[model samples]
Target: MINAQAANPFGEQSKLLETVAAWTLGLLWVLPLLYAIWTAFHPAEFATRFSLTAPLSLQNFVNAWHAAPFPRYFLNTFLLVTMILAAQIVLSTMAAYAFARYQFRGSNLMFMLVLMQLMVMPDILIVENYNTMNLLSLRDTILAIGLPYFASAFGIFLLRQTFKTVPRELDEAATVEGASALQTLWKVYVPLAKPIYLAFGLVSVSTHWNNFLWPLIVTNSVESRPLTVGLQVFSSTDQGVDWSIITAATLMTSAPLLLAFLLFQRQFVQSFMRAGIR
Candidate 1:
């Protein structure tokens, strides 16, 4: 490998170029976050100015906390994500088990329809969803915000693939030991798909946690609003834009996910790798 690389200057140059490009893109992505952190910790007058002598204070965070009903938003967001994750896991697991294990009429067609949902963007269904919510009298509620996402095609597909990789021998043994279908599934399939569940749950939680548009359209009050929508309201001209306070609020809203990813990053990567391999 060393001799081959030594003989290929172009390949070495390409590798170096790729490394530089990756770093450049990473820096670009982190730039806004860096700026937010800087401004959030500094006074408003120093928001646009860079000074080594600048004082760091927690006053901006204090003010941001009080400037909006952030506690309510936080509670709402936590509940929304939890509700969505639980529903997705339960529904997807059952659907995936059926698709992976059962040979039934129209199963392929049904699975294909689910796969098609992966291509159809949720934004395209906004108007229809709103009408549905209004018809069902669930509009402007947390349940309304989560109802559309309960049946996740992605989650179904991921779990289906994972379940299909389980050993048939284990499944048969469980059955022979007097386990019912549901019991076998609970003991065998679900446990084996734990990594995939973790991966899917993480994905679902993060996606809904950052979701803005659907919640904004569905929710009309602070009682139902998630952090993203609440943040938009906080930063709107009606609230008077204070960069310091706004950035502080932004960080607060995002802090949970950031911390979660940072802590479980290893598990996050490993779970997906396992899911992909299976």
Candidate 2:
């Protein structure tokens, strides 16, 4: 009883410390976003000024929208993400299934090679990818932006792990019912790994949607530029920095992803949980 009573104070102190630390970190993380929000909605003079009675207007957003080819950028980003996701899903599913189900010669070596890709940063391969795009005559196109990412090492690794967890009996049963290899994969394995698929799809969409450097290097025109690249070009100018307009533009470009995360946050969490993704 004495020991329990003595530990209670220490435990309370630890919890209090933890609570303070958490709020401190949370505030730090949110400070920039809060500043952006304030700047985006208020006039240029009031951007740095924190006034409770500051007038909010939508003029910044209007000016930002008219200042760039945001509509074309949006279209390009949408098409890029859609193309990359579809290709990744199909290719990753097939590759993962092959690696998980088949025991062929050098299968382990091949899988190791795939995993090696995860260790190497994509930025490191920029020169080679750019050369390949040039050789293929696909530069300054959406295809060039997505070609290097069509086969995702992370997607394959994730799906392989998910597929390995499925029972062998399901595969056998599908085969016994006169299902071909492709049919078995489609019917039995794919449905069981839906959570992983959802998780991967969301990750892929967000990553490609926000990809800037590669797209910036490959695309030269507004028609081929994604939102990230477009926003970058729009923000940098000979004129002085306009925080209100820049923040408004930043918010506009990121609004889709932010909205998606907010709306599907529960499902996103659940999908990652079910997929055992950390």
Candidate 3:
């Protein structure tokens, strides 16, 4: 009984340590975001000075918004993300269908090559991709930013997994009803896999919305600069970086996506859960 009591105390201590560790980690991650929020609204002088006494103002946001063509950047980002997601969805779905449903010879080899892209991303081939973009006459265009993401290996893999999880009995039933493969895919598989589609779409939208490197390399002017690229200008001024203004600009750049995720948090979680199940 004394040994049992000692073991119980050790277990309780371990649980207490785990709880403290979890809270510490959570606070560590949340602190930076909280600091950004603080800097975005605080005066320039108070940006680095952590204080509850700082008076919040909307002036920094207004100044940052007017200093750059943020509206244009936001519009460009929206258009680019939409274009990329739309193209990726269509291409990945078709490719996933082929991989999941068909048994063509050498299919495994082709799929392995496709999956290889997820490891060695297009960004890593920036020079070649940029040259290809130039050759296509899409340089300095949103199309250039959206082009490389047109076929997402990750999306194809996710959708293929989801599609395979769909019961073959549905395909057989539709076949017996004289439905073509396309019809069965559209009516049977696609409908059942809506959650995975949503999950993939969310993943695509979030990723492309924040993409900076390729867009920065390809886009020369404000005409094609996405929000992330645009925010860099405010953060990296030659004269001096205005921390408050830069933070405000960063906040403005991320606000739309942040708001969207906040609003759809439940849906996002549910979709991801379904995708994981598949």
Top lDDT: which candidate number?
A: 1
Q: Whole-model Cα lDDT per candidate?
A: 0.92, 0.91, 0.87
Which pairs of residues collide in model 2? Answer: none
Off by over 4 Å in 2: 1-11
Give the alpha carbon lDDT tens digit for every residue of 88-204 in model 3: 888888899999989999999999998988888666789999999999999999999998889899989988988988888988999999999989988998887787777777788
Q: Residues 1-278, candidate 2: write the lDDT tens digits.
A: 58875868789788889999999999999999999999999999998789999999999999999999888989999999999999999999999999999999999999999999999999999999999999999999999999999999999988898888888998889888999999999998999888788778888999999999999999898879899998875567888789999999999988898888888777778877866753
Q: Which candidate ranks first by TM-score, i.e. highest?
A: 1
Question: What tens-digit string does per-residue lDDT give for candidate 1 at 1-278?
Answer: 47987788799789999999999999999999999999999999999999999999999999888878999999999999999999999999999999999999999999999999999999999999999999999998999999999999999999999889888899889988999999998989998888788778778999999999999899899899999998875567774678998899999999988998898888889988887886
Collision count for each candidate, in order: 0, 0, 0
Shift of residue 186 alpha carbon in model 1, Å: 1.1
TM-score for each predicted model, relative to the true structure: 0.95, 0.93, 0.91
Q: How accurate is candidate 1 locally (lDDT)?
A: 0.92
TM-score of 3: 0.91
Residue 196 CA error for candidate 1 (Å)? 1.2
Candidate ordering by lDDT (highest first): 1, 2, 3
Compared with the true structure, the alpha-carbon lDDT of candidate 3 equals 0.87
